[model samples]
Target chain A: MKTRDLGSAAALAILGLLAAGLAGCAPGFDHLEIKIDTLPPLAVSVDPTNVELPVGIAVGITATPFDTSGDKMDSDVVLNLVPKNQKVLAVETSLDDRSFVLFGVGPGTTSISVQVDHESRTDIPATVKLQPME
Target chain B: MIRKLLLLLPAAGLLVLTGCPVTDASTGELSNGRFAYLCVDSSDPTCDGIVGKAVIPDLLAVGGAFDLEYAGDSGAGLVQVQPASDVMISSTAGTFAFRIPGIAAMLAKNNGGVVADFVHLRGVDVDHLDVLGESLAESIKTLEMTTGVAAALAVSPRDRLDARLGGALAYTWASSDPSIVAVNMASARNSVILAGIAAGTATVEVSLRSGLKMAVLVTVKQGVPMTTSSSSGAGGSSSSGSGSGSGSGTTTTGAGGAGGGK
Candidate 1:
C-alpha cells in the first residue's frame, strides 16, 4: 500500500510539471509602443517672412511636420488660428499634398497654434500688421 | 503517456509561435525633390494627350490619372475627352477639365507658353513690377501677355503676389546666365503647346527687351506632381493617410513590424 501511494504521488508530480511547461509555451501578450516626431516646430513663417501688405490682403499659413521613424504622419496634424482674442480660424489637412491652407487673413497680431496627436504647439508670437490699403 | 502528450503539445505551440517568418514593413522612398505636371482629367482633350514643354527631372513620377477637376465637372466626364497629346494648365484657378481630348491637345499645343515659361527660380533676381505705380497698367499688360489673361504674377519660391492681375501669366526661371528665362504656366493651352514643342524636339528661346532684358527658355519633358502622406499601423497592417495637416496634430497608432530588424 505504501509503495502504491508513493508511485501515484510521483506520477502526479510529473503530470503537474508537464502542465506547467505547456502554460509557459502559450502565447503571451506584449505591450504596444507608439511614437511621434515633429519635423519643424510649430511656427508661422510669412512667405516673404517679412512683407509689406495692404490692409485686407489675404495671407496663407503653411505648416510642415516630420517623424523620426521616417513614417509619414501628415494626416495626424492640425492647425488653428486665433485672432485678437476672438474668432478661431480652423484649418483642414491635405494629407495627399501634406499641406494645409489658411485663407482670408486680415493683418493683425494673430495667435497660430499647430497640433499633432492632440498635442498643441504654438509658434513664437509675432505681429502680422498689414499696411492700410491706399 | 499523458505527461508526454502534454509536453509535446507545449513544444508544438512554442514552435508555431516562434517559427513564424518575419516581414519587413514597406517604407516610403524619399521624394527625389522633383515634381511633375499631371493632367488627371480624362475628359479634358489633353488627358495623356501631349507632353508639355516643361522639362521635369527624370527622377520624378508623372501621371494625369489622379488629377482633380473643377467644382461642376464629373470625374467620369473628365476622363471621357482624353487627349491624344500633351497639354498644360495653371495650378491655380478654374476647374481643371480632365476628359476632353481636344482640351488636352490644345494644352499640348500651347504648353511652351504656359508651363515652361512660367516657373519661378529661386536665387535668381527678377525685375519687380510695381503694380501700384505709373507702370502698373503696362506691367499688368506685359504680365498678362506673358502668363495669360487668367494668370497672376507671383514672387518666385513664394506664391505671394506683388499685384493681382486680372488675367493669367506664365512664370519661368532664368538659367545660369540671365540670357535664358524659362516660364511655367498652369493651364491646358500651355500643356498642349509644350507637347507639340517636345514632339518636334525643338528648342525655342525668346528674349523680351523692356526696362530689363529677360530671356525665356522653353524645354519640354515628362512631368509629375510630388506628393507625400502619413501612415498608421495596426496589427501588423499599415494604412496610408491624406490631409492630416502637420506637426502636433499628427498621431501614430497601433502595432507594427520590428524596425531595423532587431
Candidate 2:
C-alpha cells in the first residue's frame, strides 16, 4: 500500500511537469494590433489615416502587426484582409500576407477589415477617384 | 605568253621557297592564334537596331532575351556563362536570355582557343522604377525644362521592398522626341542626362530588357541666361525631392531647377 501511494505521487508529479512544459510554449502576444507602414501620395491626410486611390492606379500597403506590449511581431502573426466593396478596391496579398497591393477598380468608396492572429480591425476607409486623362 | 609566264613563275617560286617555311594549305590549320567575336542579334527588341559589339552597354532584366552571335575559326566552339545560373544559353548556335538576377561573364571557347570578346552580363529582378522627379506613386505629370540646358534625372530600380538594385547598364534611356529632349547616359549609375534641344514637350522613358519601364513628361521652354543661382537652385531642388518617401528620387536633385511643376 505504501509503494502504491508513492507511485501515485510520482505520477502526479510527472503530469504536473508535463503541464508546465506545455505552458511555456504559449505565444507571448497579449493581443495584436494592425500597423500600416507605407501610404500613397495625396491618399492620406497623414500617416495611419484612410486611403484615397486614383482609379486604374495601385497603392502598395505594408501592414505589420504590433502586440499589446507594443513589440512588433515577425513572421508568426497571421494576417488577412477583406474589402467590403470589391467593385471599388481589390486587395492583392503578398506571399507572406503581411504586404498588400490595393488597386483602385472604380470610382467609389469602400472599407477594408484587417485581421491579425484572430484579432480584427474593421472599417479602414478607402476611396477611389477617377484619374484625369493625360 | 603562257610558256614564258610559267617559266618565270617557277623561278620566282623557287627563289621564295629557298628560305620560306612550308605550310599546308589543304589542312585546316592556323599559323597564328585563333580568334572569335560576339554581337547582339536582332532578336532583342531593345537592341534591335543596335549592332552587336564586343560589349553591350545595356542592362538586361531577368527573363529578357538577347540573341548571341558567335563568329570564330574554332570548329564547334562552346558558349557558356560563368556562374551558369545567371543566364541560360539554351542553344550554342547564337542566342541567350537571362534567368536570374546577378552579374555573369559569358565565355565562348573550344579546343582552338577562347573568343577575344568576353561579354559582361548584368541582370536584375525589378518590379518598378523610382523616378527621381516623380510623385510618391512614381509618376511624373509634367516636367518643365529650359532649352539649351541639361536636366539630370536619376532613376533607381527597386524590388518589392523598395530596396535599390545595382548595375547601371541594366537600364536603357530613350527619348520619344530627341528634337525636344535627348537622352544621354550619365557617368553615374542612376542619373541620366536629358538635354533640351528645342522648345517642345517630349517623353523620356527608362526601361529594362524585361519591358518594365517608367517615363517623365518633359516640357522644354525657351532658354534664359542660365544664372548661377538658378542653376544652383535647380540642382538643390532635385536633391531635395518634392515628393514623399524616405530617400525617394534623392538622386534627381540636379533636375529640380531644370524642371519644376508647370
Q: In candidate 1, what are the lDDT values of residues B107-175, reduced to their tens digit?
A: 111212111001111111123322211221333212211100112222211112332211111323222
TM-score to native of every candidate shown: 0.21, 0.29
In candidate 2, which residue pairs clash?
Answer: B40-B52, B59-B169, B59-B170, B234-B257, B238-B253, B239-B253
Instruction: Please identify model 1 stretches exceeding 4 Å from their true place.
Output: A1-55, A59-62, A68-97, A124-126, A132-134, B1-262
Candidate 2 chain A TM-score vs. reference chain A: 0.64
**Candidate 1, lDDT over the whole model:** 0.26
Error of 1 at A104 (Å): 4.8
Q: State the C-alpha lDDT per candidate.
A: 0.26, 0.52
Among all windows of 10 consecutive residues in model 2 chain A, the one with the lowest summed lDDT is A39-48
Model 2 chain B weakest lDDT span, ten residues long = B24-33
Tens digits of lDDT, candidate 2, B11-74 = 9998898956322111111111222223243223233223343234345545544444333333
